[model samples]
Target: MGIKAALSKPFAAYVHQRNQAWMQQPAQTQQKVFTSLIQKGASTAFGRDHKFKNIQNHADFTQAVPVRDYEGLKPYFERVKKGERDILWPGKPIYFAKTSGTTSGTKYIPISADSISNHINGARDALLAYVYQTGNSTFLDGKLIFLSGSPELDEVSGIKTGRLSGIANHHVPGYLRRNQLPSYQINCLDDWEEKLDAIIGETLHQPMTLISGIPPWVQMYFDRITAKTGKKIKDVFPDFNLFVYGGVNFEPYRAKLFESIGKPIDSIELFPASEGFFAYQNEQDDPGLLLLLNAGIFYEFIPVSEYYNENPRRLRIEEVEVGVNYALVISNNAGLWAYSIGDTVKFTSTRPYKVVVSGRIKHFISAFGEHVIGEEVEKAMHQTMQKFPEVEVVEFTVAPYVSPSAGQSYHEWLVAFAQPPQDLPAFRLELDQQLRQLNVYYDDLITGNILSPLKLTPLPSDAFQKYMKTQGKLGGQNKVPRLSNDRAIADALVKFKVES
Candidate 1:
């Protein structure tokens, strides 16, 4: 191993020891975080308005602060944006992680001094966990690339404001600064395609070892690299071995990604967001992400089934059960109180609290009461792809087709394929069957003639790319939703659809 890799051993060992302390007593760690958050928040303006002083326990907190989304939290956020201090957190946030919200057009999430470590250390620990477990820190010796939003910041209330990834760019440890690639100037490019091309130019022949980004965008980078050199990524960067990704499930893009790489490589998954860095995969073989309970954030969960109720029951960390889908709610040092970030997750293990992001709370298909979720469809797609190796998918999405041109209504699946199946009809039928096995509601609808067998709408190779470009979400942290209840995205894909 190189000097850097050898030096990481001691640091990795230290991180493992520190992590073990909290992992062994997750509930106690969370209680401490909860108590600290309440104590600090009690001094903020929002705390005063919400009666935070009386919040002696989780039950009291629930009563004091009802769960809210971006819209509900905007009142205080607006004040913070206008240079207000102690509005949300203890004082003016060091930065505002600006993000595009579905209902609220633009959002500015606070990043206070106490909370910044959560984002920075969470990512750092994910890497250290890999080093500690496998004892292979060779990747640290070479160049690393993190496909991210522009690092360029716009000032708001005298505070730096930008995308979460952009904000994170500023916090990269000094040791990694020389090892990171695609130069700051290239990263600051406003357009994604432009930035991607620039990244390829800069890292094309570098000794790259680690690549991190959302899966789809990383696939795009891989595709561009291969297309440019007429060689798989392995040939271009022989040492490239580790992939770190978050935002979307990697299963859907796994086949394509590995195909581009020309071989399987190790990867670490992270659960990060504008609000906080929540979890990361601690073991190479484990699919679950170890939730961070001591990250200056108090977590809560409302069963997805009860998320829309008049008063959904918010359960503490200890109250959550394995395998149950829950809308993740959090109160963090960033000044968010009982905030729902819209993502849903299922616990794989409760002993140390590991979870898998199941889907988005609002991104589901239930037009005909089927309630098909992202996990179900993703599983169906993954199984069908495994069964039909010849069918290489680029991207796909599902939507309820309530009004078809003819016959009974059915579910519509828009798929952009890298390699189309030889037997299109068979592929469609097998995919439908897989979905039926996963979701009884969808199966019942088809059985009772409430809907027809799902239809497959082939899309051009560049369909999703074109769609994302049109929506101004072409790259960076933005991603296409896997499924939606309404036809917004489905209808948008119509123009790019092709005859199968």
Candidate 2:
């Protein structure tokens, strides 16, 4: 075996051992770690003499604290915006991470020392697992390229941070950080054009082994790389071994990406958000296993079936059954007790706790009462795209648009295809039919005459990227809003008239 291959085996074994050790810990041990943090947070947020002792010990902790969306946290975030410390937590947080909220525009999320530790440790564990699964430690040791957001911190006052991705990039171990990359590649600290230019320049001739980021930004990076170098990504980074992506569904964009890079699907799906790095796909072969961050937070799963019921049933991590969909609720050190992050997931197994993201609870279009979710749209699109063997979908979004008349709505699909379909109408019908059959709610909406017929728009070749640019959201953490229910969605659709 080559020297690289020889090094890989033991590295893989070490990673597997560490994962097994984590998995073998008793439930009580994990719970205590979470409980201790909650106690500390409670004392810090409320007074030390507060009535609530711990998250699990207090019913008021659950009942009094209403499930909050980002908007609800605006007041606390405003404190960060004013450069105030100890607003969300007791001490001065290490930094703030600016993340985009659905309706509240942008938010400055606090990232404490402890939260940064969680992110680093989570990333380490994920990397260890990747080494074990791929049996390739060379990639781990080689230049790791992160197509992250700008590292620019705010020039004016307030908590002064750039994007969340940039903040996290700053926290990565300095020893492991690459040198050839642009000094300003840090998203939380630089201007957009300079940052993009730096990223392109640094990556031009580098032997990148790992690439990580959201799909859209990565796509933009590769597109620019190709434009600048007059070469495809594979030619530029032939040594690239792993593609790590998170923050949005990557299924639609995967085909085009692989084609562009001429690489196999050795990609890792990282389930991270501003809240925390929730989970990562352990083995590339299996569906992602929820490597519960028991050290950071207490977890509870509410059955997906209970979402609409009078009283929803929630289960502790130990109580969750295999093969059932559940919404996640977390009690974390950040002073969030029994907090529902509004994402849905389904357990594939119990022993190791493997799960698939079912959908986002709030990111669906149910305006006319159809209740279409991210997962449903993903499945329908996947199935429909499978029928057209030659075509590849690069980006797609669905919005519920109302007709000029009041109380009339329909599903409008905006799709950007890498290769145009030979039979566009048939493709649209197939997709619509798949959705209608997948969810009875959709059928009920249509049959009850509450919604107009499904509409499809084939966007211009550069539609999505242009849209992103127009919004000042061209890179890093911004994802194409997969589903939108806002009135502005209809207005945005006007920019791209129905394909001729």
Candidate 3:
């Protein structure tokens, strides 16, 4: 047996050991994790102020801490940044993940030493879970290239700061580091185009077997590699069979990415955010990602329909039912207490806790009370694209366009299509119809003449890419918000068209 193949046996065993079904005892397990977090962080100011002293169980903890977003937690985080020790987590955090802010340039999210293990190592554990369940680990023998951001570090709040992917890339164990491509020096260059070129130059001839990255950048890499070699990706790397993706939904990019691949390959969908590696595709048969219950993250759910209520129903694992869209709330070892990360998900399985991300709380347009979200928009795009097989949407975003002229408001959709639709009006009509069916509020708005029919504006090629670059979010793990409240991106799309 080959060295890597021989190692798979034990690795598979370890994955099996870690992922045993504790579904029946989910509440019991979640309560245990919650108790541990409260006790560990009690001495910290956040915990003490929230009266963590009197908290003993779920009800107590819920009443004590309350759910919070990044803004709600910002003041405390700023204190941590100013070299405060044991302020949020015990002692100071080892690093801070720089994530896009709603109101600022960036939000330096604390990354505890334990968070490194919880999400970073949990990512590996998730892969292992796939390997164990599928009994396929031969790819470990060859190269496993990850299109990652630079591990380039900065100091914020006296904490080391960079993208979460960069932080995790730095923590890749010595053993696997040998098989990873693109030297640390090359990745640190900061220019994505330059970094990708360096990666291609270094890895073009390697026996690559597994490729992992966000869908858009990964598609870019595949195209570049194919063009440079004048060969299909499968031909260039015959052993390459696994394509692991996260950060954005793969549905929109699936056809393009698969066309680049030139053959069928095993793929795994993961739900890894800056907050945690919450879930991943474990069984091939199951479409939903299996929630990582034991991975040092305690979870709660609140229905989106009741999000604005004075007191919404906060549900534990035992309380969730299949097919309900719920905003995920998490308490983690990263010193986060009942934090809401703005993402919404729907339960597909309640027993072992499997879910598909539904949308973002902030990334929705509810103007005119239509209540449209990313999932609905994407699904609409999917159905519309089906009618025109030649059309391929590269990237798109929707926003409300309110004019100074009364009764002229409508939702404006800015789309950069790789292959334009045969008839633009037909495409727009199909999308409008699909969205109306998906959202009753949207349907009512259309029927009641509260909003005009959706406006479709075609953008020049690479418009989204250029825009993201200007935002300093050009590459890894960053995605364009599918829906926006204002016309900033739509206006920019107009400027791009004029410039082009």
Writing each residue's lDDT as its tens digit, candidate 3 over 388-477 gives 888877788899987665557889888888778888899999989989999999888878777778988888758888888887778787
lDDT of 2 by residue, 1-500 (tens): 44554665676687678667657663664567665765566545332323455346434454545445567656665765576655556665666667776667766566677667777677766777777776666675567777777666663253546666667666676656653244543444434556777767766777787888888678767777888878878888988888888888778787778877876848788777667777888877786655564547667778876876765665666777776778887756554445677788887866776777777887788877677888989989988888988888778888887777743778888887768789988988888889988889997777787776688888765678777777777766777667888746545745864448
Note the Cα lDDT for every prediction shown.
0.93, 0.70, 0.84
What lDDT does model 2 reach? 0.70
Q: For model 1, how many clashes? A: 0
Error of 2 at 86 (Å): 5.6
Worst 10 residues of 1 by lDDT: 399-408
Estimate the Cα RMSD of every predicted model relative to the unseen true structure: 1.3, 3.3, 1.9
Most accurate candidate by lDDT: 1
Q: What is the full ranking by TM-score, best candidate first? A: 1, 3, 2
Location of the lowest summed lDDT over 10 successive residues in candidate 2: 45-54
In model 1, what lDDT does residue 392 have? 83
> How well is each residue in 1-500 modelled by candidate 1, as lDDT tens digits?
88889999999999999989999998899899999989898999999998888989999998888999999999999999999899999989999999987779989999999999999999999999999999889999999999999999999979999999999999999999999987999999989999999999999989999999998889899999888899999999999999999999889889888999998899999999999999999999999999999899899999999999999999999999999999999999999999999999999998789999999998899988889999999999999988899888889999888865443899899999988898989999999999999999989888988889999999987899999999999999998889887889999998998864
TM-score of each: 0.98, 0.88, 0.96
Q: Give the TM-score of candidate 2.
A: 0.88
| Residue 329 CA displacement from its true place in model 3, Å | 1.4
